[model samples]
Target chain A: MYKYNDFDEAFVRERVAQFRGQVERRIDGSLTEDEFKPLRLMNGLYLQLHAYMLRVAVPYGTLNSKQMDMLAHLAETYDKGYGHFTTRQNIQYNWPELRDVPDMLSDLADVEMHAIQTSGNTIRNVTADHFAGAAADEVADPRPVAELLRQWSTDHPEFQFLPRKFKLAVTGAAADRAVIKAHDIGIRILERDGVRGYEILVGGGLGRTPMIGKVLHDFLPEADLLPFIEATVSVWNRLGRRDNKYKARIKITVHEHGIEEIRRLVDERFAEIRPTFNGVDQEVLREIEAQFAAPEFRTDGVDDYDIAYADNPLFRSWADTNLSEHRADGYAIVSISIKKHGATPGDATADQMRVMADLARKYGHDELRISHEQNVILPHVHKSDLPALYLALRAADLATANIGLASDIIACPGMDYCALATARSIPVAQEIATRFDELKIEHDIGALKIKISGCINACGHHHVGHIGILGLDRAGVENYQITLGGDHTETAAVGERAGPGFSADDIVPAIERLVLGYMDLRDSADETFIETYRRLGAVPFKDILYPKEAANAA
Target chain B: MARAFTPKVITSNLLLSGDAVWFTANDTWSGDIAEAEFLTDEAHAELRLLEANAQTGVMVGAYLADAKLGDAGPVPTHFREDFRTRGPSNYAHGKQVETNV
Candidate 1:
């Protein structure tokens, strides 16, 4: 984890003090609600449906055990003994009072973390693959570049308050766990002839309109990243729509004005901006790179791991489901499943937070990464420690053996807490997960992602789910519309909408029918739902979704 | 053709607490929508919204939501308003927590 320098520390402390004064002013009636709303939003505070919600950024989704403890402390002290981790890999306190926000911000600053740019029209959190450093396959850790982007974008005078919020994501692995293709700007670290560089994709997002990014530059040298990205954003900032809020995102800009024209303008801007950089960012990158150097690994722990696997079936199941291959010989990347059966997808209680922190300190490398899929990743855990870690997680009820399976659903906080939501997504997700668990066919179903969003905003990344559910408020009733065949990988595509929407009561049953239908449609047990969908089109699945309509048509 | 007037209530989140609040007949905010002043007339609803918005210290995001008088008082006509009144469905939190059921 990157420690804050003096400059970083001062910047956060000053912002906290500024927000404290702003809160006082709003309370005293010196600032009107209209005036205060944007000010609060800039500081990651929102007046949600229930109480004020504060979104704290986990920069590139990497934080230390000490920072994790501070989050637990804040949740216990100010919130309802729990915190909701969002799809953006950020943690949200759903019930912080306005007066207590300043204190919470102060607490966050103490851990070298702050809520800066977690919301508002500025660039939100810069996210990276949770397995950035530890993945078995990678060009380099994307966090150093992600951290550089964070420092550059934080309080950038020129880019602040653009037409709309901008999102950037990076991935080191070719597997694309970060969902980089669905971001405004997606950077994939690539190496050519032993020299490292980036594959930059621009104008990809999922909201009212979902898009997979176009290759802005297939191979941009590592040195040109800052200037190149700056130019791209600058072009969008100058030309993007301010007339309609929906049409304001860079994706739409790239859509309306073809990528070719945008490319020309970016090139023009890059020429002007590149000279001004003069390798200062490269120097900064070198320092950041040094910080991310792999921690010391010991290759002597083969016997203990082998013995534990042989002895325990319960731990074996969890290990098989949640652990990933690390580059280091004796180490494995552990994914702590927060999506317990029938529980809210990404929420962790204060006690659970403390337990995860303790486990990270005990078995993990004192580092934690939040995955975009709403799970916590211990990027470096020795294979020998798997059994004890599995037991601790099982005791906490965090050991659900359903990663990349049907039961591991990604759902947004729908109408329940969000002012923007049209219908309830959480309950629907809960019901679906519980149903699949009851069936016990989750492992057989295999590698299916069910993402649910309350509305078209796609906060839950519903557009990219193998089975996507979008909850809409239709004529004062909760109606869920399902989409099929969306893929969120190196080769990403938006899911197609299935026929008519199902009622909230009918959604889980409809999903059950669809998944069961896919079981028969699949070519073999080895073929995943997505592979089956690709091999044979969505007609078979559509038949399952709208069986009555199909019968009527027949 | 003109749209018909529907029943409405002035609603917003409280400034300090950030909890959902409805405007009452006494010009005060109430946490419970049951105590809200339901307006049948469009002009009156606009006037109440303006009144609520002007009290900057008291409210945030003040606006009128569609409502109808029911056994519980001003019940929400739209699902969004109904959801806001009840809070999130995940856990018993917010007004759902307050109900203590």
Candidate 2:
């Protein structure tokens, strides 16, 4: 966990004070609703369906026990004893009185957290691999860079009011847990020929228009990162479309201008800003890096791991799914499944928060992370403590043992809460997860991600799910559109839309039919939903979903 | 369809020494409750807002009331609107941390 410096402390305090005054002025007739809306938005507040929703930034989804406790307190005291952990890894309090928000901000500041840029059109929270430091195969920790970006972007005068909200993500591992490819700027920490650097991927985003990022620079030297990023943002800032909100994101800019042109501009800007670095940025990065230095590992032998795996079927099953290859030899990166069967994905109660906090403090090395897939990670759990940790998690109902499986769906809080949502997403996700679990088909399916978005904002990353469900509001009726073969990985691609949108009543059944179609079409049991879908294409699945002869034939 | 006009907290900003008490209600604070103007036309909305502001006084939460102070005059933490407006205070329970002071 990175502790806040004096700068962070003062910044949060000042922001809280500033927002407090703004609230007062609004009350005093000095500010109109329009005037106050943006001000509140800048602080990560939104006026949702029934009440005001306050989204607190989790800062790349890293939190310590103390911060988790504070969140628990807020949920219990201010909210309805539960917090919705979003796909961006931020925690949202669905019901907070507008008046109580300032206090909420103040409480967050006390924990070295604030909700600035969790909303509004500016750069939102910088996300990264939840298993950053502890990943078995990572080149280096990505958080230091994520943190650096965090500090640089926080209240950056130039980018405060961009054309639309910008997003950035980073990953240390070759495996893409952070969904880096779906962000405006994705940085992968890399080392080539003895020197460390970053692989910069730019102009990738998901919304109404989804795109896979192009590699802007193969390997940018570590020192030139800030300048490189600054250049990219500046180029997009000046040239990005402002006429239409939908076309304003860097994705559209990259698309319209082409990757080579964007790269050339970014390089030009980087060169211009290179001389001004003054080594201070590097020093800051070095300082942050020291904070992320790998934890001490005991050299004790753990020869029993294989034997335990062979003996225990449940542990073997859990290891098969929940564990990731660690950068270390004896340890494994653990992604604890928060999405239990039939439950809303990415939601954890106050008690669950506490248990996770305790687990992070105890079995894990006080290192915890929230994945973009809406799961928690005990990144560097020792192979020896796995059984005990598993037991504890089972007791707490946090142990689902399904990480990338079908039941572990990524679902957004849809029409149930979001004012912008056209139809319900959560129930559809729930029913699908439940259906698969009841059929006991989850394990056989293997490594399928089903993501649901309430709307085209694509908050759930529905655009990149193996199975994507998009909810739409059709004349006061709820409808769902399905897309297939989208993946959120190294080979990221937005799913192709299935034929016609289904009614709310028809969606879950349609999904079941689609899955059955995939099962039948799969080459072998090893073929995942995505692999099968890619090989078969959407035609067969479309036929299954729209079974009527004319519709199927089309 | 009948839409009831309740004093909606349109905008909330914490001001002064970090007091979170005030929020705009019908373009003016009314201690979290203001008699709203029913709008059939633009003029009625404007008049109702003006009258409400006049009746409720300045955008002050309950703690700002002179009578509520009793022996202790004006404690920032003591105001509910202060809590609502400013958010939580330095004192844990919205109690005056130093009552003697």
Candidate 3:
């Protein structure tokens, strides 16, 4: 993790002081509710149905043991001993009194953390691949750049207020684990010739409207990244839709004005601003890069990782699902699966947090990551440490061996806690996972990312899942709309809606029908759900999910 | 009519660190609210004050009001409507105060 510099420390301290003063003024009759509301929301505070909610940023979803301990302490001391981890790699506490919030922030600041830009129509937390520094296949660690952007965007003078909230994501690996295509600005680290740089993708986002980002720059030189990104956001900040709140994201702006025009504007702006950042931001980036240099590794380990691979069936299954190929020899990057059967997606209790903190200290060389897919990663576990790590994880219920299986769902809080939700998402996710587990057929079904969002904000990234389920309310009854063929990979696509919405009672069965339909149509078991969906389109799945009514036809 | 008015009620939480005092519609935070202080028209305020007394350490903030001030009972619905029409208007220290924008 990137440690805060002097500037960072001063900024957060000043922000906390400002908020404390604001709270005092609101209480003392100087500031009205409307004025204080936006101010409070900007600091990740919300006035929910029953009480006030405070969301704390877990930057890029990465947390160390000290940070996790602080979070656990806050939950135990202030809240109901539970905190909800969001899809955007943040944790939210549902209840915190107004007076206690300032104190809570002070506690968080002790650990180099604050809730700034976690809300409001500003650049929110800059997310990146959870496995950024640790991924064996990474061309470079994306976090240093993500960290640099975080500092630049955090309360930047001009972009303090905008049409709506903006999000940025970066990934260094070939696999798009960060779902870069579904962000306002998605930067993919690439190597051209012998030099490393970025392939900039812009205007991709999911909310009321969903878009697959367009490639803005084929190869953005490493030196020009910050200024170029600043140029793009400056352009979007000015021209993004302000008339309708629903159409305020960059996606709508790109759709309305076309990507070519956006590119032209960004280029023009980049030219103007490029000179100001000459060598300064690059120096800062160089400093950040030093902090993230790869850990030392021993080469005299495994000759062939097949001995243990052949002996254990469970390890074999786990190895297949939980491991990603590393560019390093005698080492593997492990994604410790947290999507246990019937558990809340992305949630880790205080005990679980402590266990993960311990595991990171032991096998992971004091490094831990939170995947955007709602799983944790211990990136640099040696091939020899696999069995021990697996056993420890299994004891904590962290090992379910279903990394991309049907039960490994990514779900938002939905009606359970969110005041903005239309229907329940957590229960639906639980039911689906439970249903699939009971059938004992998740393995048979193969890799399927079933993402569920409470509403159209797409916080759960329902728009870019292999199978997306969106929960909506029709009158008082809950309804679910299904979308298929979407992917959050190197080649991303916005999901196509399957059919008319299904009633809450009918949703699970409809999903089963769609999955079974895929099985029937697939060329072989080797073909994944997403692959088959892309090959055959929505016709087969849609027909199965929304079969013609026999009674009406009769 | 002095006959009776619906009680205005607001939903709020007790702060973790607040003065141990009772808030009154008369904009007073006093420590002298007792069960017997409930008179016919002053019943709602008196009851709320007593309730506030129980949560001594908790910070007292956010109150519902219908813009009506009398000894009449507080109507929760009217206060809820007022809260919706205008956000959490009053802040509490030792007393309720209408904040300025």
Candidate 4:
């Protein structure tokens, strides 16, 4: 929703031109692959397994109808008629040719979007809660501060080359939909004595070494947000190890030097840099806050919605699963499911993108959000308009009402597209979702988060899933290791591994057994899989996952 | 004793299209894995890989991948290399679409 000013537009256009030149040089033999690889990565272009992949930033997962249309156009014109929305709230075009990327970027710049900082060692796209403005429990819209941070970090000279990639997330609600605990810096907007402030956490990350952030500042004043964040990153930038790529992330740095020492260092750095910020950041934040103002709501009865919910089982099931509580009266947040059973998680065809864009324009107050769970959000749909919206989604095959269920999985493009993946993730995710749907008990299972990663990079946030499936190559065979009871919420904790791995063929049945076993183990229907796991611990679940071993022991 | 040397083929992704390509016996890049020059000796594989890496303007990320001689030609020995030749399992968009494999 933050419109690009003249300066922002100029900067983006200039970067596109610069990249265009770099691409030309690379093709013409002036620059070698080694020289051009980093430049291409900085522009969010990667030489993936099958083709060039372009990652376009959807800042804080916010999009207008026009921008959505632009993404559809890019998919139709430059890519293979579909785009994969990633866990970082960015969209990646998987098959763009090397020569067509500059034009693709130029097209993106026209829509106030670019792929800048989507990759590389710079601060990546700063994600926030998908329900930032519409969530009923939010204390404030976190996007204003998120936008301010975007402005501050984009092309910042001091942070151009950190030890490794840095990620930041913000959430205004206590529910923690943004998974803030697993970021390098996680900011929670808080209010005390009717004055707004922040609670800052640092050194959280999910990779080979997963960590939940430690509280660096229990409460930081609203005015000191920028300076304090800069101080924290600056301290890490100086002290973070460069000897090994695996040991370079801030989590390892924090682990090596305890949180207290890191806190002390951050405090010392904050003292040095706190005076440098002269309150201009606050002014910019206020301007951004105005742009995020709530849309005009219609104070009308929802008689049609009520009738549809009562009469049609299909509509009722969809409405029950897909809708979330809105902050405004008579409005509901609609989460459009991109993970239809047997489809690639997070992929939306060009036609589907256009349909979502049209829906946003016609009924969703021109606002759309890409959730980190690989779903799309119509943040401000009126209750009166729900029936029509649902009908449109149903026509597009987007009405798979399995949000927060076992069928609603978050998966990375593992060996399927990624050059670094050790095994395939998408097929595993597909099989699991399809199997669950066939079982017809996803709704019964209730509020399960199944996240799969191709490798240890944790791009799918598998470490935080209620049921995490990690794919790996074991002696050249595809193997999946399961982790149980991970929570991505405020009480975030890494899942515990359930024992030995399963072959690709056995994985789906293994998951089915685990879920079915939970059904028997749960005290009541109200007890979710995660709640039961927490109550009984991983022993029972491990038995369920490794049934052969358990049977042999018995 | 050292493990027996596995036969290998030099592979890279084409610069323009970013599709998987293998060094053929004819000293040119081919998208089809069957057309690759399968090297049985370790010294030959290393030399071929180095030669393939030098074609920077044509491709990127050249490396040696395990292969075994098939009835037609060289075939991938690992699943990753097989996926590279055939494309992703979920879709028919990559080499599958082009080569009709």
Candidate 5:
């Protein structure tokens, strides 16, 4: 992780002080709610349904044990004894008092963390692939460039208030784990002829309007990354729709003005803005890159891991679901499941944070990453350490053998906590997971992703789920609309809606019907739900979801 | 022509406590929805929402929630508003844990 320099330290301290003053003014009747609301939102504070939610940035979702401990400390001190890691790779504290937020910001500053640009119509926290450096398929470690962009975008004067909230994601690997296609600006680290650069994609996002990003540049030189990104967002900030809140995302702008025009505008703006950077950002990038240097790995390991996998079925099941191939030999990337059978997705208690922190320090080389799927990743763990790490995780109730499985669903806090939600999402997700768990067929069902969103904001990324469940309020009744074949990978496609909405009571049964139907429709067990959907299309799933309509169609 | 108002209650999240609060007839915020003042008139609901919104030091995000008059007072008409009174269904926290005297 990039340690904060004196400038970084001073800037955050001053910002925290300024916010403290603002909070003080609001408390003393000197400032009205109307006056203080935007200021609060600018600092990642939201007046949610029941409380003021403070979303703290976990830059590119990378954190050391010290930083993780600080998050645990904040959870214990200022708010509840828990933090909710969001899909954007940030953690949100749902119950912090207004008077204590300034202090909380100062506490975060002490750990080189702040909530700036995590909310409002600004470029939100820049996220990257969780397994950036450690994945076997990575072309380069992306965090350094991500860190550089973080520095460049933090309170960039031109983009403080854009047409809407903008998001950026970077992926270093060939596999699109970060859902880069669904971001405002998605950068992929690429290499050609011994030189590294980025494949820039723009106008990708999901909300009311979902779009797979258009390739803006086949290969943008490494030096041009910062200014080019600035040029792109600047163009968007200027011309994006401000008339309607729903159509404000850059996706709509790109849809309206075509990517060729956007490319022309960005090129023109890039020419103007390129000079101001003057290689200063690249100079900072070199400094940031050194901090992200890959950890030293030993060549000899795996005796204990082999024995554990052979001897312990429970350990074997978890390892099968939760472990991924690491770039380092004899090392494995461990993903700790937050979606335990029927628990709330993305929530980790203070004790759980401490446990993950302790594991990261002991075996993970003091490195941890929060995945966009709302799970924690220990990027580098020796194969020998797997048995011990798995044991610790199991004891903490974090080891659920359901990573990328049907039960490991992503859900947003819907009407439960959010003020904007039309219907409840968490309960729906819980019901689905519980139903799947009771059936004990999640592993048999194979790699299926079920993402649930409260409404159209797509916070839970329901648009990209294999089975996307969208909760809507239909004339005072909670209704769920299912979508089939939504893929979040490199071959990203928005899921097609199955049929008319199902009532809250009927949703789980509807999903069960669809999955059971998929079992018969699939050509082979090797065919995944998405692959089958690709082969057979949405008809099979739709037939199961709405039997009466399918009967009429037949 | 203006549309007629449905029954509504002025609601907000308390500043200090961060708990859901309803505007009462006595010009005070109450945690219980049963103590809320149901307004059937459009102008009166708007006036009450404004009054609640003006309590900057006490409340945040003051708005109107649909409610209906019960034998006691007002009750949430929509499930979403009903959920506000009983915290989240995930776990028994916030209003779910609290007991009234």
Candidate 6:
């Protein structure tokens, strides 16, 4: 995890002090809501339907045990007893008070974390693969580049007032766990001739207008990364639409002007700005790289893990589903499911947070990661400790053997908390998870991503799910529209809409029908929902989604 | 012709707590929607909204929401406003928790 240096610490403290004064001024009527709204949003505070929401950035989704404990403390002391881990790999406290937010920020700064740039038109928190350092297929750890971007983008005067909110994601692996294709700038680290470089994709986004990013650069040398990125953002900042918020994103800019024109403009800007960069970014990156060095691994035997897998069916089930192959031998990446059956997805209670913190401290080299799929990951867990870890997780109700299964749904805090939401997403996610668990066929369904967004903002990344449920207000009632055949991996594609929407009451059963229908439709169990949908096309899935239409046709 | 104006209530979130509050008949903010001054006339509703917006120190994002004169008092007609009146369906933490008290 990246620790705050003297400069970083001072900067954060000064920001907290500034926000505290702003809050006080707002209270004293010196600053009206109009004046204070932007200030508060800059500090990651928003007045939602019921309460103030504070979105705290977890840089590249990396955290230490101490930071995790502080998040738990924030949840327990200030607002509700749990925090919602968002799809951006940040945590949102939904019920923060206006008066207590500065103090909350101060508390966050204590652990080298702050909510800065988590909102607003500024470059949001730079996210990366949660399995960056520990994934088996990683070419390099992407966190160093992510950290470099964070430092470069934070309070960057030139890009702060961009046309719209910008997002950037980086991944070191070939498989797109970071969902790089759906970001404003998606960077994939690759090696050619033993020299590390980046494949830059520009203009991809997933909101109302979903677009797969186009290849801006085939390969840019590692040294030119920051300059290249700055040039790209600068070009977009100049040309991106300012008249309409809907069309303000770089994706729209690229779409309207065409990627060829955008690329030409970016090249022109890159030529202009390339000379000003004096290798300081490289120095900072080198420093940041040291901090993200992989932990010493234990090369011990996995006899205990084998014994537990052979003896205990529950352990085996959890190991099979929740564990990912680690880069090191006898090591496994443990994804702790916050989405327990019948529980709100992405919400970890303070107790659960503390338990995860303790587990990370004791067994995971004090490193923890918040995955975009709304799960906490101990990315460096040894296989020998799997039995004990599984037992502890089971005791804490975190051992839900459903990592990529139907129950592990990615849901946004929809109408339940968001002021922008049209319908409730949490309830839908909970119902689906509970129903799927009840059916005991989640494992059979296999590697299905069910993402739900409250509205068209795609905060839930609904467009990328194998089965996407978008909640909308149709005729003043909650209606859910289903989309099929979406994939958020290397083969990223926006899921196509199936047909008409389902009532809120009918949605869970509708999903159950779709998944059960998928089982029947698949040639074999090994073929996942996405593969089945792809092989057979949308006709069969469309029939499954609209059974009434199928029945009427028959 | 424009659509006929529905019954409405002036509502905003309290600046201090960020909880939803309705402009009551007594010219004070109330957490309960029942105490809200329901305006059947569009002109009166706009005036009430202006009054609510003027209380900058007390609240933020004041706007008129669709409501109806229910058996008890003014009730939210839209699901969004209803959610504001009660709370989120997922947890009993917001207005629902306070209302129980």
* The best candidate in terms of DockQ: 6
The interface RMSD values of the models, given in order, are 1.1, 12.7, 11.3, 0.6, 1.2, 0.6
Error of 4 at A306 (Å): 1.2
TM-score of model 4 (CA atoms) = 0.99
lDDT of 4 at A77: 99
Q: Please estimate how well model 4 matches the true structure, expressed as its whole-model Cα lDDT.
A: 0.94
- Candidate 3 residue lDDT tens string, A1-554: 67888988998999899999988887765776667779989899886533578989988777777787788778777765656777788888866778778888988998899999899999999898887776677888888889889888898998998889999999988888898988889999999888998999898988788888889999999999999999998998899879888888888888889999999999999999998986988898889889777777657566335776888898888989998866567778888776778878877766777787788788776777777787878777778777888788888888788998998899887766565777668778888888998988889999999999988888888888899999987765678989888888888988998778888788888888788888889999989999888788777677777678533444
Q: Rate the local accuracy (lDDT) of all candidates.
A: 0.91, 0.78, 0.77, 0.94, 0.90, 0.93
Name model 5 segments beyond 4 Å from true.
B99-101
Clashing residue pairs, backbone N/CA/C < 3 A, model 5: none
- What lDDT tens digits, residue by residue, belong to model 5 across residues A1-554? 78899999999999999999998898888988789889999899998877789999999999999889999999999877999999999999988988899999999998899999999999889899999899999999889988988988898898887999989999988899999999999999999999999999998988888889999998999999998998999899889999988888999989999999999999999999898878888888999999888888888769999999999999999999999999988999999999987889999999999999999999999999999999999999999999999999989999999999998888888888998898899988888889999999988899999999999888989999999999999999999988878988899989888879999899999998889889889999989989899988777777778888879988
- At residue A452, candidate 3 shows an lDDT of 97
Tens digits of per-residue lDDT, candidate 4, B1-101, equal 99999999998899988999999877789989899998999988888888888889999999999999899999998999999998889888888878721
Q: Return the lDDT, model 6, position A390.
A: 89
Q: What's the TM-score of every candidate structure?
A: 0.98, 0.84, 0.84, 0.99, 0.98, 0.99
Give a tens-digit lDDT track for model 2, residues A241-327. Answer: 999998999999999999999988988988898898898998998898898788886555666677778888987888888988777
Steric clash pairs (candidate 3) = B6-B75, B7-B73, B7-B74, B7-B75, B8-B74, B8-B75, B9-B76, B15-B59
| Residue A10 in candidate 4, Cα distance off native in Å | 0.2
What is the per-residue lDDT of model 6 for residues A143-229, given as tens digits with 9 covering 90 to 100? 999999999999999998999999999999999999999999999999999999999999999989999999999899999999999
Cα miss at A343, model 4 (Å)? 0.6
Task: Determine the iRMS, in angstroms, of model 6.
Answer: 0.6
- Fill in the DockQ of model 2: 0.03
Candidate 2 TM-score, true structure as reference? 0.84
Per-residue lDDT tens digits for candidate 4, residues A1-554, read: 79999999999999999999999999999999889999999999999888899999999999999999999999999998999999999999999999999999999999999999999999999999999999999999999999999999999999999999999999999999999999999999999999999999988999899999999998999999999999999999999998899999999999999999999998999999988899999999999999989888889999989999999999999999999999998899999999999999999999999999999999999999999999999999999899999999999999999999998999999999999898899999999999988889999899999999999999989999999999999999999999998999998999999888889999999999999999999999999988999999998888888877889989
Give candidate 2 misplaced runs (Cα > 4 Å).
A301-312, A550-554, B1-101
The C-alpha stretches of model 3 lying farther than 4 A from their native spots are A28-30, A300-311, A549-554, B1-101
List all candidate RMSDs to the true structure. 1.3, 9.1, 7.8, 1.1, 1.4, 1.0
For the second chain, the TM-scores of the candidates in order are 0.92, 0.24, 0.29, 0.92, 0.89, 0.93
